[model samples]
Target: MATTKEYRLGEFTFPRGWFMIATADDINSYKPRQIRFFAHDFVLYRGRESGKPVLLDAYCCHMGNPLGAKNTTSYVVRDNGGTNIEGDCIRCPYHAWRFGPDGKCNQIPYSKDPIPESARIKAWRVVESMGAIWIWYDPEGGAPEWDAPALAEWDDPAWVTPKWDNVGMLAQHPQEVVDNISDYAHLGPIHGSTVDRYENEFRGHLAIQRQCGGHRTLVAADGTRSILHTITTYHGPGVLISDLTGLYDAKLLIMHTPVEDGSIQIWHSLVVKSPSGAAKAGITDAVTAAQFQETSLLSFAQDFEAWTVKAPCINGMFVPSDGPFMKQRTWYKQFYNPRAKERDYLDRCEGVYVPKGVVPYSEATVA
Candidate 1:
């Protein structure tokens, strides 16, 4: 796998952001589920008491046992009670050592000794929203500065149920995936879309791309085209949401979470407005929603195929029509470096390519 230095992103391999670890329905309180992200192992489980999700390092502090593993003899499943988990805390399978949601060891079954302060694993800050579990990660071990995004469409009664596709993982750096936002030249050839207007806007950690175009598709016996107005926004580095208006009022969610130094796990989901305008419209057709989801997956597959097979572009050769690749990349580097290093990158690359009417979100005015 490629490293951060391989892509010339910065010193840090992973960027700071709220990345999706798993869907909410994927985990349960029955047993701890083991997950690997950022090249590290983590255990996720729902708290039996609070009924909330908990995330912590996968290994046990006492004997280096995996907390998620099912062991009949280990105290995790047998000690004090039939199950190892008491409320939200998870017991180590080997020694029955209970660790709280805060990552500190609270109880020891065999010994009457005080738990050592060092008997703790790292507890990650996690939030459940939009049917997914997002974990906040900072290379420097700092807290999240911004909140995860929430869509108003999620709560709207007119929208149909959402559908998700596990696009799976690709062995490439996330910088390569994020680069697609500023890539305007590829719309015509790659996705069969004629771009009327393309622009990129930066607002602190958020990156927004607006594209107005007509997408060509086979609507009938003869090939026909439909005009689509799309506005895509990146909440941080990992999550992207696109609101598209044309034949349908639809929303597409694309999330890329780094599973290793150079690989990312991709997820795609789509939701569309229901034909019937009722809150509990039993009239919404599941078949129509599934068909729309299939079309969305086909459109996304074009980008996914190219990203998986192509060579990594560390320093891309830029052109006038290629969009603001340099500016976007500089903004992306801020997430990988310390807060202090952000200014230097901004100073060097800001104002290089400001869109006609869009204001650049930087401290200094563009020349």
Candidate 2:
């Protein structure tokens, strides 16, 4: 695995954007769950009082105790009936220092000393959406430039909301994962896609790919294969949502969050429109959606297989026919840099591009 410095991605080891830290199910019990992301440990839980998701730097300011780590011995946990969580606040198992959702110690037992302003941990801004919890992580610690992710069809009854597939951890930099957006050549070999048209575009934080072709995988429930058209876009640095058309009209999500400098955890899910074209999805639609999700996971696994052991492409021997690798990389750099330099990077990369000898997904072109 290669470090962010190895790729010269800019100042931040992790990029600036919204990233998934845990699935909504991970906190359904309302228990504090320990999570690691962006190379730091954090405590994630649903606030009992506010009923909202909260993320805080895992360790306490006093004695450096982990507020989220499970402990059965501490009276705090024992008295709280197996949890140190008190409403929206968590009491440190070591010292019983209660921290509010804002991460400030609001209560300190025994000692009468003023609650020092320094007695606190960093609180992360988080949002619960689409069965996932997301944090707006910025190395510069700026407010979110964009809202957390959501799918319109997620609430629509006509779509079957499939459970998220646990793709597990990958020991590779996210840059390589983002490279797949413009990976035209890989379609045929990796996915067995007989590509008829392909193109890519980079605009601001969006790296998009538009392609359509016949595919060997991702067949219909009846085992039918047809031309697949997908318009895939990276919402920021970590979230990927693809609108797919072919065997079924579905919204596919492949999201990854940096676990550290050179590793990430990934998840995949498919929200498929009801096959029966019913106004509301039923058990049969869910079964079909789950099956299609598995097929989608299989298709994604092909790329995961290559990413498992491939050397980091610090500098690729890229070619025109290989898609716009450099431009895609340029677009990725914006997140690794200060917000001020975002426009500079976008100026260099924003535009539509079609690989050499391939027909554009759309007839329009930019200079």
Candidate 3:
């Protein structure tokens, strides 16, 4: 009989950080998209003329009509997409209440008086990286410091990045995806194309070092497996890079955030190291770009079908292939354990589910 290792359910709290919602590609497609998460709605649009990405609440402050009307209003105005903007202001559809990107009510279509500050809906800080957009959930007035973990050849002219593909799995709890990443046994059966040959034998202490950019690198070293995997993660509370085998060979940058309690928004990217004489074979930039876009999408789709039908919460059952899941649970505790003293907080706090929308402050303070 196989020996059972020490594994506990609810053993860790999912890190409370800025979760990535959409990629830069999603907004560039000329669609005014609204992603609802944590019980709030954020609308994404391309900035006028400047072409910077802007994120704000969907409702216009004036009469609460959606600021960017899909398939109709064009979500653009003044060289940008959206409704009318008198000055640096957005107008409402119902009453034309002009508002700025900061969510400040700037004009009243009918009223001559200036709007009170209380009427304004504040805008969240938006950050762009790896061709994606991120927003913070900082309730303390202080935004989470921007942390952009270093990526291999991210800005290199020689490497071209493919447009990202958004994915979703019909299940509650973001932990499921985390579990999927840690569960290596399933790679062969679920994502066998590129992952079938990799082996997961290492079992090492996980140490997370916060870098200069406000992001983190979680290093796991298991001597037995003879493998070292460094997960280059970001402050959007998302994973920015996965340096598993080596620097540029077979790397992945995963941007995942919550859509709701059970649903998730996932965007996956890849950076492949070129091989000798591979260029002459016509493995050109365009070809590699298309491959990353297509393969990553297919991989997530497979996980979607698998996780959606598996279970609502995975902690209820145990599987033999859960060795990696067991290790990942240990790593998640670094986020919420106040005192940062405990190796496992899920054991101390029972019946606790850090579902999205629940205020992170209300939970136990982090050390």
Candidate 4:
């Protein structure tokens, strides 16, 4: 039975939002990378011509076979739509239908006239910045356009940052990943006490703060003391940056790219404040080398194990000490609630969950 539900990662029925897809390396290497953003089931291909980056669609709508997964074909097709640096078109493997980078079916082997304009598949709105590619997933098309989060240091030459990048599966909703950032209880156990007793509270505003680089941290208070998280998000929907105060002398930035529904491709940028002379001598080179060697492997393995094993959708579970989770629940409700402004009056209803400051259920009900 195919349910209208999109994800099978966990108990979660994922609502529409932008998700992280891939890291910079995944698409920038010699071989092009193909990624799928699950919320809308959109696929992207990072094609290049003369060393220039081009991101386009991968699947053919006519037959559903992947467009350019092999080397036998030109790997790019020309649609009647338009051609870019990578060429005007490519040939499909299954039926040999031609497609342009714009995802139009240029020609059918037997048909004389070109494919219709309505037959073309869609391409994502990709923004490349801070060494990563971000895609927008706007289901209702109501998603507002915003600038990428400001990261001043990316262009600075003086700073040397270590990086760990990888793609992995998370048996959870996108919201679960974001909620983990503010969930303090798990930090002590899962992250090995990296975060201490953090107090989270609702500030009831789009709380934004400047970080070390051009990254700005945003927090919206829900209800829990531990759920108040500092999230570094860009103007678009998909990119997420987290400044880890515990890793690499306490200055590391994590960028999460949505590849699809069940997983994410990550870029871990470990920015150090400064290093000693001996460490600084070859430290940048050393750290970059280690990133490809040890750090990336270790971090990916650990996170993969942690998130996959836990209840993927963690909101329903009641843990008295999980203040952060509680807070995030409130945030989630507020974020999706259409009547958020009038939610206070609605709290008077029976059995409807409300945050602490809202009228308590005990007071509203007769004992």
Candidate 5:
């Protein structure tokens, strides 16, 4: 498996950002779900009383037992009244030790001794947003400084509910996948799109790619190609939100979470505007939304198919029309380095251009 160092990404192996771990519906008060990301095991669960989400290291600090273990007869659940979780804390299956939401060991059953200060696990900062559960990961153990990108259309009554796809794990690094945003040369060969104008912008932790193109195959039956104007933004290193217009007003959510050194888990979703505006009347048309979702997924699958088969691109030969690959890579390095070293990277790289004073709905303003 190829590592980030092999690709020469930066100083850190996993970049810092709010990466999606699971959907909002995936976790509930019933039982804790075990998930793996950044080469570490984590337990995700919702508070039985507070109803808020919590993410903690999977291992119990007392005896190294899995907190979210399934199909096991252990003291945490079997001996402790058959319930492994109480309120916001999860009890260890081996020793019946209870850890709070703050990852501190609070209870040790049958032992009169007080819980030691070292009896604690690491708890991650998590938030529920955009129909997904996002965890803030900082190697330096820092808090989130910026808000996740907001999808305003999600709340609009005219748009339908967002549909999602769990693309599963791919044997490729995220930098290779992220490079596709600024990869202008592949538009024609990969997705059958011809570019008219392409530009990329780097703003602190954000990288934006604006493309004005025409799709050759994804057009009307009359073979009339519709011009596509898209604004793709990278909220940090993990979440990508693309606002697309032309054939349809749509929003595409793409999330990449690193599962290991070289592999990543991907999730994508699409939402389109409703024609009849029945959503305003408190009615959701599932049929129309499903039809549009199929078309969007078909297009996204093409990229997935190609990415899975190709070898990792450690170094690439560049051309003038290849877009801002170098600049984007430099911006990506900011997440890998500490806050102090981020400026060193920005000083050596050039930031791309983002069109100012252009409305998204107007096609005439694309040029």
Candidate 6:
């Protein structure tokens, strides 16, 4: 797999940002989920006591026993009716040494010997929102510089909350996906968009793309099409949220988190405003929202298909007609480099851009 060094991303193999670890529904007290990302293994579970998410290194320090992996034959597990999870803590199946949610060993089960302070696992901080859990991953071990991905619409009663579509992992590096931010030309060729106007902007942590056009896949089945406008922003390097106004007023969330150096996990979901415009979304609104999400998923699948098989774009023959790919690439470097150098990278890329012959989004209309 091509690594971050190969792409010259930065000194760190993984960029620092808030990455989706799992959905709220994924973790349970019955079985901890073993998750792999950033080239490390982690155990994620819902603390049975607080009902909050807890993340720890998969290894139990007392011994080499894998904490979250299933062990059906062990008495340590079977005695607990199939799990070693003890309230907010998890007991090592091998030695029965229980570790608290803070990743400290609180009990030795059989020994009166003092539990060394080092007899613990590595715990991670996680925040839950938008029906998902996110970890603020930083190689520098700094607190989150910004808020996790969220939208007020997720809390609005009139918007139907849709389930996340796990689009699976992409073998390609994230640079391939992040490039889509300023990709003005592909919008026409790949998605069959007849763009009337387009523009991209870079400001601080946000990479914004605004466009209005007629979309092919998002239209009605009987060959009816309407003007679609999307104001999309990369909240950071990982989360892409597009507020769309077209057939339905909706917000499209396309989230990707690095799993390995050259691979990333992508998820697609959409929150559609009540089709009936009712103040509170009804059962019928939910059904309509599901259908709309299916259509939106189809749109994202178009991009997913190409990224699945493409080689890395280490060097490209960029032109003025193309979107500001180079600028966006520089913007992405901020997350990979030290936070102190963030300004240096941003100074070079932060600005509004329009392709050579395109009308700016602020000036475009369907007519």
Give the best candidate by lDDT: 2
Q: List the residue pairs that clash in candidate 2.
A: none
Q: Provide the overall lDDT of each model, using Cα atoms, as 2-decimal numbers.
A: 0.79, 0.90, 0.50, 0.43, 0.80, 0.89
Candidate 3 vs candidate 5, lDDT winner: 5
> Distance from true position, residue 104, model 6, in Å?
1.2
lDDT digits (tens) for residues 1-367 of candidate 5: 4899997877789999999999889988657889999999999999888888989999987778788768346655765466677898888877678889999999887789877899899999998877789999999888886886567787777788775688888999998889887777777887887766677777887888887767854444454437777888888899898887756677888899999989999998877777455656234455666666777777888898988898887788876556678788888888888988888877766466433333222343543
User: How well does candidate 6 match the true structure in TM-score terms?
Assistant: 0.96
Per-model TM against the reference: 0.90, 0.97, 0.66, 0.61, 0.91, 0.96
For model 1, give the RMSD to the true fold: 4.7
When summed lDDT is taken over every stretch of 10 residues in candidate 5, the lowest stretch is 354-363
State candidate 3's TM-score. 0.66
lDDT winner between 3 and 6, please give it.
6
Model 5 TM-score? Answer: 0.91
Root-mean-square deviation per candidate = 4.7, 2.5, 11.2, 10.0, 3.4, 1.6
Model 6 alpha-carbon miss at residue 367, Å? 7.3
Where in model 4 is the C-alpha error above 4 Å?
Answer: 1-18, 28-32, 39-43, 47-57, 71-85, 88-90, 93-98, 105-115, 142-144, 194-197, 201-239, 244-251, 255-267, 274-304, 312-321, 333-367
Off by over 4 Å in 6: 219-225
Tens digits of lDDT, candidate 3, 85-141 = 434345555666666767777777578776777777658777777677777654344
Whole-model lDDT, model 3: 0.50
lDDT of 6 by residue, 302-326 (tens): 8989888777888888999899999
Candidate 2: C-alpha lDDT: 0.90
lDDT (tens digit, per residue) of candidate 1 on 27-79: 78777888999999999999898888999999998889988766667645765
Q: How many clashes in each candidate? A: 1, 0, 15, 25, 0, 0
Candidate 6: residue 5 Cα off by (Å): 1.3
Q: If the candidates were sorted by their TM-score against the true structure, best first, what order would they fall in? A: 2, 6, 5, 1, 3, 4
Clashes of 2: 0
